[model samples]
Target: MKNLNEPTQENVEFMIEEIKVKLRMATAAAMQASSFTVERYEDIKDLYEVVASKEKFSISEVEALVSELGQLRK
Candidate 1:
């Protein structure tokens, strides 16, 4: 596993990719890791943790998460 404690571009990319996979996002192709930055690392990590803890999610939950991610984007 990658060491995600550090706020690095690579770590951000890893977390974003993992979140996308875990969420089974239909628009995963549109949400590239390059769209994110270390400036929002903590927010992204928080979202990643929320996503990682759940095996499934309701449509509303997914929408909310996606919206949060959109807000965090550069």
Candidate 2:
């Protein structure tokens, strides 16, 4: 497994993919990892951790999370 604690492009991509899967996002095709940058690595990691720690999410929660992600995007 990749050491996600490291803030590298690969790690950011991995986390973004994992987040998409975990959220079961319908519009995931629009949320490409390439849209993000290493500068927002910490924020992305925090979002990843939140998604990872949860098995399911409410509709509102998912909306809020996606909104935050949109804000963090390049």
Candidate 3:
């Protein structure tokens, strides 16, 4: 994205929500568990990294989603 180190509060908030939407969309596409391969894993990893980079404390929230995503694909 925009090199989000020390990003503005508004930008960080927007990004957090944006990442959530992206994850949701990806999850929808992968609900059958067929798309749970390397590409989807990388996308989730990138989403977590983007959120974690801006707000360390929020990593757990994303982690939960990531974990659920994995389980759903299994």
Q: On TM-score, who's better, 1 or 3?
A: 1
Residue 19, candidate 3: C-alpha displacement in angstroms? 1.9
TM-score of each: 0.96, 0.95, 0.31
Which prediction has more favorable lDDT, 1 or 2? 1
Per-model C-alpha RMSD: 0.6, 0.7, 12.5
RMSD of candidate 1 to the truth, in angstroms, is 0.6
| lDDT (Cα, tens digit) per residue for candidate 3, span 1-74 | 65445434444444444555555544543344333443344454455465555543344665676675555243
- How high is the lDDT of residue 19 in model 3? 52
lDDT tens digits by residue: candidate 1, 1-74: 78899999999999999989988999999999999999999999999999999999999999999999889999
Candidate numbers sorted by lDDT from highest down: 1, 2, 3
Ten residues in sequence with the least summed lDDT for candidate 2: 1-10
Off by over 4 Å in 1: none
Rank all candidate structures by their TM-score, best first, as comma-separated numbers.
1, 2, 3
Cα lDDT of model 2 by residue, 1-74, tens digit = 67988899999899999999998999999999899999999999999999999999999999999999899899
Write out the backbone clash pairs for model 2: none
